[model samples]
Target: MAFRRKNWMAGMLLATTFVVAPLANAADRVKFILDWAYQSQHSMFTIPADDGTYAELDLNVQVDRGAGSGDTVAKVASGAYEMGVADFYSMLRFNSQNPDNKLMAVMAVDDRSALAVASLSATGIKTPAELKGKTIASPAGDASRQLFPLFAQANNIDESSISWNNISIELREPILRRGDADAITGHLTTISMAIDAIGMKRDDIQFMAYSDYGVELVGHVVVARPEYVQSNPDVVRRFLRGAVHGYKKMVADPQLAVASIRKRDPMANADIELARLKMSLDYRMLTPNVQKNGISSVSPERIQRSIDQVGPVFGVDPSTKAADIYTTEYLPDRAELQLPPTGPASSTP
Candidate 1:
């Protein structure tokens, strides 16, 4: 009888394993690529990923670093990555060029443009007009560089007057420090922090944000191929829910969010990342529009304005509509995306 009892227990254990295995494997695997290396802004994805937010939604997400916005757009359009964080304007250009393989933004993450032309105070570059006849160092595929023509058009800077020095991403700040270039164009927070990392005070750098110069373009967004989004609508919705939870958590406890970056990149400086995260939140992510409308929401008029501004610069297909670029179907409910009162602050480093 004891032997029979032992055998029954063993049989139950076997049955349990069989039952749990499929459930364990049932999670929808997702590969999420970022616009650049892991930074504090990325905590919106990493925090939720590490803290069981994605798991709660049955999502097994793998976050990977990206080369740049342009690369991320291409990778997602090619279906190499199911989702990616990328510049909205860069995706616009890609869609215009590849209408058949269009990528669409499922969520507008950064409501304000961080695209800027930054220089040391010593450069005496006080305005966008002053950027003419100067050397601007940028990556060949940088979104900021791609959008410079639009910036120049709005600010009346002759696009032909500025010389673009195509450099690798690693050299962006170093070239500026060495004075190899008079200024650099990239995400404002990223450039400022990089300058600060290399022994220069962020305040010493002067930034001419595109938004301030009549180029009110939207910033980075979460993107996926339109076909993938249509086929896996539920998966996209779940991912956005998890992402909103992550962003809310990051805003509530920035220090925790910054620390989460170390899980993927052990050498990342939490202090610097925290500062970067805060700068982005203050200037880009948590803007008045985002605060009022909730995260991932866009105004139709504003998006139309952006499209109007970017259309000529990118030579976008005349038929491309605002609806072609973004969709609100996957965003979480407004309540879930609302920021906390104590936004972007931390109790400790």
Candidate 2:
């Protein structure tokens, strides 16, 4: 995982010249793959398209939307893209299936999981407890779907009583709207899009966000293959630097981010920006442990603890290398984290 130290030293000199030389425009053509299609939270990766931010780091990134999270990891391991974003647990599950396909997490976009049960306001379903005996529209084989049983237990809802309707997005909206299903297993971002699509304001819907119910879990991350990081540490560092700035700007003004997303994809769910931004902020996705320490800081203990919790279920060796799964080297330093001072904190709809 070594690189030419001399080149890195020169890069440091370039950093010193930032204010004086007015950091020249980025000159590298970098490509990153997304775990799924684009949406609001992707502001970190899309800010280059939103504004002229990438030029400063001598980086130009092309974003590709496709490939499931599991497949995305394989592509990165194969050096198919400079970076890819995928669910945090996908790596664990992937390792369970094939240990050699190791990919590394760089920056986690979310501090905790946002999975939840969403329902229409017309139904008077205000909490997860109300979801008992209701039909739940779920995507078959979804990790969250499988985890729903445990979450249901956590909420004291009888998992057996809740009917499961294997469904897709197109049908989910209609099912809830038509009263076929009382609620759907959804992330806050999805609920944001759902309400907006129904031409109804959020005030008209009653949703139970999982984080509020004490079901917070880790989420997807900006990732790459360990080999890629070894080959191009500077590239990773520059990209994350710019991305962290993008997220800071996003948390600061999600309305602006909505415009940014719309600029890239006309139909991209811009409405989700408000919910995404609010949820991320309230739950400390951007600011989590930032005030106490720093963003992107993962202790070896924290990593090891999480490994121990899931290793048994996934069949990973208990002592599997925690350091191999992620690296904080490419992340920005204290000054660069630069999370905008917290404004008013609020909950997600």
Candidate 3:
């Protein structure tokens, strides 16, 4: 009886050790913050996390919703987060202002900016020229509003001719719906929220994409603090690899990506996120350049042009260079980063 008791105790101890060993060898920890609340466009980040893509690369990632692109950049730069997603232009501006404390964009998420003027079809405000004598409603801090100068110059519209009705974010769409304003300036995904809130049909909305009018600028990007990158280069590489893997999965089935988003923000409407994700993928993410060079990559000339264009607009230091905005050292091979074609499908709740 004593011999049997000893064997049983030894077996239990071995079982406990085996169970604890893997947990002790845990994955590298990374905290990622998004440019905004958990929305459809952020599925690439969330889905990879929810679906275990980060874990597959031995990355134990924690993702948090953010206030805005500027806020996200500040957070990463201040060491509040190890990494984040933010507007590349905003990142560049921040770098220019604080030359010593710089954040480098690892991946260019969208080849073209999704900034646009969204209006009701009834308004017939389709072109930047059409908005010449009209009133535009938007938050004072809105990205599209900040970039309006470039958009205006590209389309040859006189900026002085238009009036900006600086208002709260929630009121921008409502005033437009009531015909109080001619149009609203915001990202396509953000504008879609108002359309959904007002119960407007898709056919009733028109988007004047900045890219369509010769405003060549990169959109959102995955960014990291320069110090963090220098300290953990391998971790950065693994992080980008996991993100690209997750993004590919998202492109193949955006519905699944929406599900992953819902998991993060249970209050999110699936249908709305689904539509937003699809629109973002088609209109913003899947550009001709991205198709050829893969997501997260950019052309040197275009990026340099963007730096030259935005630097003066945002008061960037004359010493700031295009290379200061982003780096390609940590990106995976272009072939591995190509996103598959999106298909017509829905997630099974």
Return the TM-score for each candidate structure. Answer: 0.90, 0.78, 0.89
Candidate 3 per-residue lDDT, tens place, 1-349, comes to: 9999999999999999999998987898999999999887787777768878888888899989999999999999999899999998888878878888988888888777888888789987767789898888999988889888999998899999999899998888888888888888898777876678788776787778787788887889999987889899988999888888777877778788888888888999888888788777777787655766678768667778888887788888776666776788788887787655544322110
> How high is the lDDT of residue 204 in model 3?
81
What shift in Å separates residue 167 of candidate 3 from its native position after superposition?
Answer: 0.6
Put down candidate 1 lDDT per residue, 1-349, tens digits, no spaces.
9999999999999999999998877989999999888998999999888889899898999999998888899998888899999988888988888878888888999888888888988989988878879999999778888888888988898888989899998799989988999999988888888887889877678888888788888888899988898899999999999999888888888989888998888899988888888888888888877777688778667888899888988888766677877788788787887775644422111
- Off-target runs (Cα >4 Å) in candidate 1 are 1-25, 343-349
Residue 247, candidate 2: alpha-carbon lDDT? 79
On the 0 to 100 scale, the lDDT of residue 114 in model 3 is: 80
**Could you report the Cα RMSD, in angstroms, for every candidate shown?**
3.7, 8.5, 4.3
Best by lDDT: 1
Tens digit of per-residue lDDT, candidate 2, span 1-349:
1477888888999878885563454377778888766666677778765577777787878887755676777777677787888876677667667667677788877666666777878888987788888888867655567557556766899878988999875677667777887777766666656667777677766767665675545667888877778888888898888888887777777887777767767876554666665655665465446544545655656666656655665677776766878677788887777565675444554
Residue 283, candidate 1: alpha-carbon lDDT: 87
Task: Decide which is better by lDDT, 1 or 3.
Answer: 1
Maximum-TM-score candidate? 1
Model 1, C-alpha of 52: deviation from truth (Å): 1.0
- In model 3, pairs of residues that clash are none
- Model 3 regions more than 4 Å off: 1-24, 341-349
Ten-residue stretch with the least lDDT total in model 1: 340-349
Selected candidate, larger TM-score, 1 vs 2: 1
Model 1: per-residue Cα lDDT at residue 291: 75
